[model samples]
Target: MSGPGYRRVAVPVDGGDLAVGVWEPAGETKGTALLVHGVTSSHLAFTHLARRLPGLRLIAPDLRGRGGSHAVRGPAGMEAHARDLVAVLDAFGLESVPVVGHSMGAFVAVVLAHRAPDRVTGLVLIDGGLPLAAPAGLSAEDTVAAILGPTAARLSMRFRDVDAYLDFWHEHPAFAGRWTRELEAYFAYDLVPGDGGLRPATSYATTVDDTIDLTTGDALREALASLDTPTLMLTAPRGLLDEEPGLYEESRLATMLAGLPAVRHQRVEGVNHYTLVMSPEGADAVAPAVAGVLAGERSTA
Candidate 1:
């Protein structure tokens, strides 16, 4: 049987309630898998995967800055996101859920698994997890700047109306080819009427700050090294950046990640960074890989 449709739920975390979209299967399953979306993206990114994983309970959060969970204040860094995931688990009374992260969320998953090994049963890293390849003399600032690209360009939309803001995203190149009624509805849910226009429910500054923090490679590697949770690191042939070859070279990513014990690396050819997470093709490839990893873990247990 196929996975059920997503149910919107608010998970309390400290002072704020983080919004999560859950898609659980009809019958008994192995375990819950928490799906974390990348920066600037929302739970909507997992629409395809939610439909595919019929036997697993899927919990996808809006993180803190991207979707319905944007009410949070302060710098929404990886640690904050990781803590939020823990809070969600606590609220759900679930121990050791398999946490799947895409892009920036992937890094957050790694960090969460590292910080709270007992909380995360397994980790699925999608098109993220490895550090970017650095040149001989490139500074951290330069490396971060390269990762940000134009998507990091400041954009404050003084929308003529909420529909205008919705239209803006509808026509966006990143989303243009894949716009669906579900995504359209997801976009609309996160737009709030503001001072004569609509502003994203999320804080722009919070998003930017999170982006800056995640691009750095130093603390993440340290965190990954500490993670004893079973990890499934899936890399897209195309990187997160629109570049054909991504920041994490397949050979290099596997080689570097090999140092981490019990980590399985899979190279999914033909999908780019973003599409690899959002596309139906990506869901098809990723869902089975995740299921296989979980199955292998169960066998070992």
Candidate 2:
């Protein structure tokens, strides 16, 4: 298969390089889009989304430590992620670009809009933005244990071959029945030979620290409530959470998000956390939602 309309560009951030991939539209770009991948995912996750939106120039960055990006040797958090995104925009000589973020990337987008309002024209948040409210009294270790199963396993294995790494993801609950060559290539991109075989480039430590910070974060609601940037939040009905049959749990997330004045939230009919970004279903469903937001922003501009 052909690679993404892809090219690697670097931005200086905290004395390190921010590796980003660009997908130029086939024709005129409706608008330039800057995309941020979810936790532990790379720019590859946006291939389907890029394929779907041929009218927009898309840039997908490998956040700090994932994919081809180098990890910071010092401390980092969501704020750092936002700053790196700003750096990317600056390097490209872009101003007031529309930003599309998935999962953890969405959280970063929220913070970016809140902190750097002038730099953003509009925002599209996919399957995230709500405060990661854990059940009260859940310990950091408990949350880590609960969420780190896949990370731990992914990081633990040292694969001599990429196929071994692909096999692991092929059997994962999230990818069950959703496997495709694109997905496999994405999984392959996450590995590098280490110790004896391949391991994920995203440090297990970063994943753990990020999870704790995300779940414990208290500022998202406050951030969204204060931001004036026109925003759209799209979530999946069965996001990393189990819900009662036939219930639209994502709509509940959307309802909660409705509190933000300039924010409009919606739940796509059939999608989940991972598939919400990687599959054709995800791209088809999300493109129009995002296009609608960009169109609205253009009209008002």
Candidate 3:
């Protein structure tokens, strides 16, 4: 399907290149937004959001060990991911800009704003940012498995062809009844030929490292503790599997926000964690808050 056009750039980093997808506004740009995707997703995941906000220049990057940057070696984690974001900004000659992240990307955005506050003007976190509750005594690997579920499992699975991969996602709980051509593009971009078949572009090992860091490491805590930038978090009522009481429990989220009064919270209805930014309805629910945040206005849904 036809949509907003974007240009790709390969930003040089320490280990390898970070692939950045840049979308420029049709006319004059209102501002710039750096879009970060979730653990097992890619830069193309922002297609819907980019189309929704045509006035803003959107910059999305395939983080190390994911998407076109799959060859990028790492010790992947929030800190390292944050550093790669800084490199993307530097490559574009941007000193600071509003940062928007979804799911795991939310953790990366917080760490970026925390570590390089001078490089971020504001933050919009969709369906993530706050610490996730992990059961005591769970190892990092186990935590990744539990949190990601089928999404993680797909990383190791091989597909006979592109259509086979599409069929798999067609049945995903999060995308059920909401699939669109935009999503098809995003999914198709995730495939890479390997071992006489196709596999997801994101590295399973990298996802594991990132999951452990966000859930168990101290970087997120430090980032949240020192959060000074204007931050807004939008949560989905459902999760990846379309289950109730998504990623963050309501009462638990309230308690977490009680400490960081500066970060405002808003609930977006009818969308799951994945659709919060990937679906048209989800983008409609989110674009306003994102625009409001960038415009220096507080928005609620």
Candidate 4:
């Protein structure tokens, strides 16, 4: 399927510029959605999801330290990222919109809604947002290592060419049996020419800082405590590596969600962390739920 067409916009923020991709609907827009990508991913990650929701105006931003915004110099954490998201809204003249976030971006979305509740109408957290279990006594860096595993390791490696980088991801367990043109385009956009090689556009230092905050910081915890916006959490059965027992294990997810009655949960079968937003099947499952949330918001308005 052909994805929605998007125009790139540069939104200025405190430390630097945030690159945003704006996708207008084919007809009258039912509502607006602010789509946020995962850690180490760019706005391109939302292409599949955009195609699934052609009636909604989609605004996706390449957060600081990633994609075209890799040059955005500043401290990296949930608060800074949340602030940048607000800037994105201001630049686009959007007073409030439903925010959709995937993976680490889900955590950022929660913080955004918490810090700027007036700017968010609702939230859709795909494959993330709930607290994760981390081992006790591990340093921040070590915790990141344990949580991310190979996904973290790829940030330090360099590919000789774009083809080489594509080859690397062609074997990633998450993309196994699910590669498509959309996925290819997303991956290709992540590479940039470096000294003697091609490197992912995401900054490793920024990723580490952000990862530490999402994993160990108190911001997300506090955000969940007072979460008043209508929220939906879609979880994949598998994980980043296509490993069984995805990010939020069944019992643990239940335990974590017990306190947040406002947030709804759904299990999307047959997809993993990356596919939950990057593949057609994943988009099919998510788009309808998002539409329902938008409809609910309109009814209550």
Candidate 5:
């Protein structure tokens, strides 16, 4: 975290250390907030968010089996992740804070709030949170494949060097013309030395375990059914590939959110799933959204 106003902290959990990224303003501050990155993403993903909200202290962690915490032990599931997050809160000696989660991180936020409702004051879900509809009768493996597409495949890829990895993401549809220095740093942080070359630090097995659990596990179902936390869901119009309708199709989201009056949904224009938080245009929408969450206000973007 050589970037301005950022520092790293290691919070010990049951199985291993949770790598946390803390960003503080150079001067006065408003308060603190917890940020949870997407599956396969590291705490660095929130670098842009941290800069935009400099007045607010930001705490983001590399979840078990991802980023610097990739080796953290234990099964991958929502409950397990929630427990790790609770440990992070305890380490900071903070009772509760507003939470902002991106992609799969939003799923973790839901469970975190449900299991330890007192630990989260409000939730800001970026391009995720409400569950995606799993195709009927699909096997768990197939579900992972169908849902994640190229994202899951990248874990198996080996890059000859840093440039090769950057080349890979450089061609990604979601990031076309949206690249930045932060994006460069993000992809570089993803690599760890492998047997023959540099491979991504995120564990493939853990990704499978988490994807299966989030898609079919009972934990998420139980959590959302009883969820009462103040939450706002911001969605990107496009998905991981810059495809239309995103993870939550317009018609589908309306139906899925119908039952949960406690949750609110707002669609952000001109961004894909990856850009909704990582890019400047997306951050313009997302950073201000946090203000409403902390103020306990219900409004649309």
Candidate 6:
């Protein structure tokens, strides 16, 4: 289940088709869950989660602007992503399933729940979902750069080959000394031929479009503001590059969760935003949390 064993399917969406990966359970299926990846990341980000949750079917999709769906022509935003996700569920005949979204995917999940409430049973938002704001006077491009930093820059970089790309990621602080074969495979899948070399398959233009829409768009704020479904927001102590004070600070998270009683916040130690869903330790922590959501259990911060 750890290898690239998931069945890849192209789910048709508006403007084009979306690439989705489905991992059917080896044993009697306990349940099904839809896993959404981050901005600039593919569905392979859930490789660790697939290994941990082998009993349940895991369906993950490369967002319209990333991975196999990078060529999907359309605006990239919460509403666009939510529409694509609903189509993915429809293709699988899934009436409703618990959703686990990481980083920007979490924000998309919130939008999906808001847009089509009955389609999502519950939500597990890892390291994202709350509305994000950029410094005043920042331009659209700089806003994305300020929030994503290297993650956005890497989209335009070209590598000599897959190994070169692997080397680049190996030096990353969040991935340093923690790289696995699964991670290597995920990085390899991220590249596509470009300009006499290979560049990440994620569309830089779409990334910027989505970032600006999320940072300044009213959809996400309006969605979270009127939230009603049960949600668990997991935070990592370290930031994207293993820096201190991850995405959600306690004071800030508390203030954000004040009016939304359905959203609960919990911090996962010894992990960063990337590792929270890309590492074995992270999968262990998240797998059970998803089960709790499916079972209607109350998760406390």
lDDT, candidates in the order shown? 0.74, 0.75, 0.89, 0.89, 0.89, 0.88
Question: Residue 205 of model 4: what lDDT?
Answer: 88
Error of 1 at 79 (Å): 1.6
Give candidate 3's error at residue 92 in angstroms.
Answer: 0.7
Give me the displacement of residue 113 in model 1, in angstroms.
1.0
Query: What TM-score quantifies how close candidate 1 is to the native fold?
Result: 0.85
**Residues 1-301, model 2: lDDT tens digits:** 3333567787778857877889885556688888988878899899888877767788889988778884655555677788889899988888888889998888888888888889888889887766654556667656765654454556656877888778777767666787787898788888765888777888666766666776676546567668788888787766453232212254555566567787777777677777888898888898887677678778888
Clashing pairs in 2: 159-197, 159-198
Cα displacement (Å) at residue 272, model 6: 0.4
lDDT of the structure predicted as candidate 1: 0.74
Model 1, span 164-253: residue lDDT tens: 767776655555476566566666776766686776666667766665666553457678667677788888776654466765776777
For candidate 3, write residues 159-222 as lDDT tens digits: 9999999999999888889999988998999999888699999999999999999988899989
Question: Please, what are the lDDT tens digits per residue for candidate 6 over residues 1-301?
Answer: 4432468999999889999998876668777899999998999999888877656788999999799998899788999999999999999999888899999999999999999999988999999999764687799889989899999989878899999999999999998778888899899999988997999999989999889888889889889888998899999988889997887777877887898999888888989989999998888898788877766722331
Task: Go through the candidates in order and give the C-alpha RMSD of each one to the true structure.
Answer: 3.1, 2.7, 2.5, 1.1, 2.7, 2.6
Winner by TM-score: 4
lDDT of 6 at 207: 90
Q: Rank the candidates by TM-score, best first.
A: 4, 3, 5, 6, 2, 1
| Greater-lDDT candidate between 3 and 6 | 3
Go through the candidates in order and give the clash count of each. 0, 2, 0, 0, 0, 0
For candidate 2, give the lDDT: 0.75
Candidate 3 steric clashes = 0
Q: Which lDDT value does model 5 have at 72?
A: 91
lDDT tens digits by residue: candidate 4, 1-301: 6556679999999888988998886668888889999889999898877888877899999999999899998898999999999999998899999999999999999999999999999999998898877787887678878888888788888999878988999999888889898777888888887877988999888888988898778899899989988899999999989999999999999988898997999999999988988888998999998888889889999
Q: How much RMSD separates candidate 2 from the native structure?
A: 2.7
Candidate 4, residue 24: the lDDT equals 82
TM-score of each: 0.85, 0.89, 0.96, 0.97, 0.96, 0.96
Residue pairs whose backbone atoms clash in candidate 1: none
